[model samples]
Target: MNRKRTALSAAAAGTTAGVVGLVLIAAPAGADTTPPALPETTAESLVASVLTTDVPALSGTVAVSSDLGLPIPGLPTGDEAARIYTDGEGKARVSLIEGDGEKTLVADGATTWLWSSADKSVVKYTGGARDKAGEEQRLTDPAAAAREFVTAMGDESTLSVDGTARVADRPVYQLVVTPKPSERTLLREVRISVDSETRVPLRLEVLANGSAAPALSLGFTEFTPGAQDASLFTFTPPAGAKVTDGNAEVGKHEPTEQQKQDLLNAIKPKVVGSGWDTVYVGTVPADLLESEVTTEDKGGREGGKTTGLDLVKQFGQPVSGAFGTGTVITTKVGTALVTDDGQVAVGAVPQQVLVDALGQK
Candidate 1:
């Protein structure tokens, strides 16, 4: 839900496409039963409904299954489940079950807490009324995820309602989105099941080219819309848990306009190409390029540490072109090129697409 963390995890694990794919290709799969018949609605009206629908107070369990075919150090693979709770206002809580522990996040008004049972660590963040950290967490929800994708995929995509099905016991209209013929992407099509009554999305599925089964899917197995208990959004760090102030120096000083722009420029990646084949070009911190990620008892590799550059080199193949030489990491739905000079070009496109992206000034 943290955009910065998502980007870092994607870069560290060579899952750029997987992370980005979650947003760009959000949808749902079909149910095995006979398709349900729902009142006819145009794709435009369905998309409009998702955009206008205000999320109600609810709690649900999300089942996530990903087959990116790429390994991210320190992360578990295969199917995983997460619990979500929201008060329909500005308060929310999410709990994710890890291998032997749990990670819980709660956002109560201006304060947000992230507790990790694995490390016995707690991080607290405080911001003003406009702070959207909690709202962004909604992206993990099927409804919110599908809403974002529908909003962004307009014009360049073809939208249609193929049929209807039941998701989470609620009848839903199946809205399908596919890239136009001009867009070159590894993905096939996205299927989203929107609730017929409330118009909220209930499930989403993404299929990659040449894959009959969904390459990635996230949807609610259970959903209840109502007022959540107030206690769910409140949090207090456990005794002896390490506490870190996520925004300790928030109001300590004001940055100059130039300084603010400079920082933004440094963090924002340069966009190359467009549509589903869009590439993001950015510079990795010099120190990070020399950094190493260590894992303990993971996949029979005990206490193994790999540097950033070494990581790409080990997982990628040597590649060179007009943009110069680099190592390219390829997966089922994406590719990433890490040049020797700490520059990275990542996208859901092919290796040559990455090369061409970098070739442009």
Candidate 2:
């Protein structure tokens, strides 16, 4: 649990490429066929405007599409769509639509409810847990995602206003972000569509090197900027559904100081290099290294069974270097190296970059 907390914090800070990919997944404006006409504006002004603009009460449908090209067994891919409602006053609701059921998360200023329709279960959060849930909810918001990139942009990047386009039927200004010549990354550029009137980002498109289309795209398919129903922010568990207090077990089984240190030493999360080439280095927990992830049969369909070692043998290629022998899993936007000794190095860079990162002391 401590490792999970540490890893999540690291990812939230943008220190790991894998988490960056996930955060980016949390929401893009896709390319529109016809370009819109917009008045002359500087990237500086646009950035400032997006940062300062107050988000008004709104509701929309968010569509996430990814083509990472890593078809790991049991991993969900392609399109994931959700509906979002916000009162623009710290109260919000997000419903993630799955195969046949829905998972809804609602935060009503002071409390948060996470309900799963498929399992008929709900988790209620209060106090600090409620606040944490609200923060995680914003990660899936396109405007928040856009602001993340804009704020994360550093001297290593070059930004400019490319053109104007219409996203979700609203005219928007397109801002393009590209890495400097010295940065080594598989990503080519990031494109964001900012609403012309609200200055809020409507869509984000991330294209990889050598690819014409965006490897990942997230945006609102339907957006309405106005006050949302107050009822949407409140939730009541259905009859017969099981409810659990999310904060009830906070100190029920606290780990000793030595145990915490031991777990931290075992994982040993480390970052090598900087910028887009940065790699996240860690060790595979012994339990996971020895175990496998097998899908369970659900809805009468036969579950596909596979092991961790099986995946490495099936999808990874053998690589050996100064860092030692391991298998490297390559995707359209990133690469992961898994050493035979249970070490791992992952980054949005070439395989050699991962190898060099692992070789670093």
Q: Model 2 TM-score?
A: 0.82
For candidate 2, which ten residues in a row score worst on lDDT?
A: 24-33
Q: Considering only N, C-alpha and C atoms within 3 Å, which residue pairs clash in candidate 2? A: 28-203, 28-204, 28-218, 28-219, 29-203, 29-204
Candidate 1 structure quality by residue, lDDT tens digits, 1-361: 6999988887877776677768555654433578777889999999999889887898988887878778755333578788999887878898988889998989988789989999999978887622444543565688778887887778789999988888887788989999898887888888998888877788899888898888778888878888999999999998999998766544445577898887667655799977788999987777788987774564666677878788779888998887677899887778889989878999888788888888887
Q: Please, what are the lDDT tens digits per residue for candidate 2 over residues 240-359?
A: 999988777544555779999988899999999777777999997777776866655546565667767666756788989997788989988889899988899998888988888887
Q: Residue 35's C-alpha lDDT in candidate 1?
A: 72
lDDT of each: 0.81, 0.83
Clashing pairs in 1: 27-204, 27-205, 28-191, 28-204, 28-205
Error of 2 at 306 (Å): 6.8
What candidate 1 gets wrong by more than 4 Å, as runs, is 1-32, 73-76, 119-122, 129-136, 236-244, 249-269, 285-287, 291-306
